[model samples]
Target chain A: MHNLEAILAMGLVTLLCRATPFIFFMKRKPPAVLDFVQRYIPPMIMTILVLNSFKGLRFGLAPFGLPEIASALAVAALQLWRRNALISIVGGTGLYMLLIRVL
Target chain B: MHSNSEAPRVKVLGPAFTASIPVLLGYSTIGIAFGLLVVKAGLPWFLSPVMSIVIYAGAAQFMAIALLAAGTDIVQMAILTLVINARHMVYGLSLLDRFAVCRRWKGYLIYALTDETYGLLTTVSPPEGARSESFYAAVSALDESYWVAGSLVGAVIGGLVPTEYTKGLDFALTALFVVLLVEQIRSIRRIEPYAIATAATVLAFVLFGPANLLVIAILASIAGILAFRRRLP
Candidate 1:
């Protein structure tokens, strides 16, 4: 019910956002500064997004604790190890889950 | 338009495939986390990766989840997502000249103009006298494939994970970006963008909060870098 409606809304939003880039830039690439942006923005944004994810850092869904610290450490470690996106993700998630469940 | 027979598709294909291995591995895991998080948030099973594949924009997906979790309206969600992803306008314009020559591949290339793909293609000049169009096509397709494949993997993992266990996994995206930036820094001699970006990020975060920080940071960095470049020579 609520979930389904949200999904539909998300789906619609996703479609339009994803397609917007293609439509605007069709057969027309901008200059070098823009090119630099296409390269650099993601990494910068990712840093912010990741940090924000842990902003309210909590355990049992409320306040600062072990799980966030552990997951952050795991993500940093895995990222350094292979620089492989999938591995970093799985490794981080797996470690987070293990910590939450066992520790 | 160059006929299909003249395109050196394989030459471009090889590098695209080789380069994407790291991307595939990274994106799949990221996708998996996305899947687990969105599903954990109580979204439908089918929509998680569908958004990934269709939208194929990671940050936008995260925003979508946040907005959905709060029961925000469709129009608001849609507009916010658009504002967030509006940076692609810059990416598209940068590739205007290169794409102009790629007639047959243009339509599909336009469809797949993601951040990662644009990053790789814009930096690498095609081999002398080789088909630049083909190279662009190969890189574009390969990058999109990594994203699509990663999303599917995430969807699969989300389907299996329980909601209570989904915490802290979100940091994976952060770690992933750190790794990527470090990698980019290694190849780059240009430190101005890095410096400008760091400064802009700090400024934007303080001024605008995290919501519009990335866009503001990028715009500022671009201006700073351009000004600095004029002083270079």
Candidate 2:
């Protein structure tokens, strides 16, 4: 029962956050402060997300985040070149898997 | 008779599917990962799709596994859900104009606005000659369906794979995030946001370590942006 409740609670909270803007802006223009947030936050969030992925890697440890670093670099370069998201992801993951096994 | 009526609506499906193919790949792999983890944690098969439907936030679901394992309560899960997926509001706000005219689908649209869907919608316009709402609806539904289907498959197959064999399969999610991050950077023109955000993440990691890093990074990024906004412009 609690598990189900937790799921519903999560869904409801998610719905509320998503609905907040649409409801608030239904009758009025969003404020300038919101405009600032709208403009600047996406990149910041994206950067944070990218960093979040590697948070488990101990920088000072033996493998030293090398596989992640190499794969990330490969992802960036491949994406920049081909502009194909699927290629970048697959290529990077493949390289990461290989590096982890080899090194 | 039903087929005749459905013809126009079905025409929109192709573009939507094409646009969503990348997410189909990302979500399927990550959804599988989350499903496998949940199974490893001793949950039932149906719970994977249930959680995917309700707690549709992909990244947050990964975080939730730890809490679920620890037997966290509903209230705590709700709060955690809010904190992690709070970014959805930003994406929602950005699309307020586009979504305003899409009133009837607003609820459904908001519900399906995950990061990959949001990013894809940001880049791609509605298909030519298609009903605008239909295009958005198609893309949204397709993405979620990919996730649900993936989780369902993952749930069924999860127990079959030995734990040792699943190593580094988890990197698919990270690789997907990196791919989207690259997409975000390409769309964005400035260096300051990236630089400031990097510094904030590094500083937060150093100060707070991994446990509190998310809250710290979010705060630092927001603060850094506010303080530096005037300077930038």
> Which one wins on DockQ?
2
Worst 10 residues of 1 chain A by lDDT: A42-51
Give all TM-scores, in the order shown: 0.63, 0.84
- How far residue B176's Cα lies from its native spot in candidate 1, in Å, is 7.5
| After superposition, candidate 1 runs with Cα above 4 Å error | A1-103, B1-7, B69-71, B124-130, B157-191
Off by over 4 Å in 2: B1-12, B63-71, B124-133, B161-170, B231-233
Query: Against the unseen true structure, what C-alpha lDDT does each candidate score?
Result: 0.61, 0.78
Candidate 1 residues B1-233, lDDT tens each? 76765666656666667655545555655677777777777776566766765666777887777777888887776688667776665555556656768788876776566655655565556755568877778777766666666566556665665545545444444444544555555555566666676777677777887676656766776666666655432
Model 2: per-residue Cα lDDT over B1-233, one tens digit each: 76543665877888888777667766877788788888878766777899899878886777776777777988888888888777676677668767767856778988888877776666566776667777888899999998988788778896565656546655765666677678777777888888888999999988878865765786688788777767664
Docking class of 2: medium
For residue B158, model 1's alpha carbon misses the true position, in angstroms, by: 3.5
For candidate 1, what is the DockQ-based docking class? incorrect
